[model samples]
Target: MKATHQPPTHAPVTTADLLRMAALYLRQHGWTQGTYYATTTPTNYPTPPACAAGAIGIACAGHTVEHFTQLDPDTLADYLATLAAFVDHLDTAYPMFLIDDDGFALDEHTSPYSWNDDPARTAEQVITALEAAADESDQLHLTGGQN
Candidate 1:
């Protein structure tokens, strides 16, 4: 007899849920994704180089399982499962930015110039990028309301 796999108790993961879960995980584990470390000293605030030359921002870090969240219930079990799968396959949940730490000050793979000038892309464009990333990874099973 074949053993049937049991479905996850947590709900599906969504874009909004992803952010929330990430924040929650960060808070719970005291894990900083270089998010707290702004780009600039005074926070360039809509200007170029939000942080220092090698500061951590939102473009150089890799995503993890804790980045995922459930829809109905805000539990982290679902997200953890996703992360587990990602690790098993040696796949990154998503490409993210982080602080290098050993460099100047929280240094990581940051853009040479400031990314402020670049106007924010439309929601559709952002969604498209996410979908593409998920497709490439082959583990991102996005639901309808996941956006």
Candidate 2:
């Protein structure tokens, strides 16, 4: 026999869904890899010890189970923008994603997941990023449409 986690009821993930799930996971259960939390999982989809990338990926693609037969990707918000505007707006929300107190955020130069997995990384930081990404997504929508 094997222990398996259940796929959440939420489906057809939206940007808001991704943002909300990631932030909430960090806030409530938290990303266990970093911080002083004692929870870890040899299996997958451990909600009590959520991971930023795992949460985001699960919401985005259901990495652990079959949550959705179709991903609509548009239920989150009601706007769109150009790439230039997006970059500009991103700085407004998450300029800190690339910078730390001593400056230079990423030391490993791996991926955002690695950044999330850093033991020095705080749950608040991941939560902020998730919230900021949602904000940036909304900001992009102000452009009317992709440009």
Flag regions of model 2 displaced more than 4 Å. 1-13, 34-46, 61-110, 143-147
Best by TM-score: 2
| TM-scores of all candidate predictions against the true structure | 0.25, 0.49
Candidate 1 regions off by >4 Å? Answer: 1-74, 80-119, 139-147
Model 1 lDDT at residue 18: 42
Model 2 per-residue lDDT tens digits across residues 1-147: 346867668644346546666577667765666422324544443454555654554445434332223334542121121222223433554343545688766532234445567768787876777676767666554543562
Instruction: Name the top lDDT candidate.
Output: 2
Model 2 scores a TM of 0.49
Each candidate: RMSD: 13.4, 11.9
* Candidate 2: C-alpha lDDT: 0.51
Quote the positional error of residue 74 for candidate 2 in Å: 12
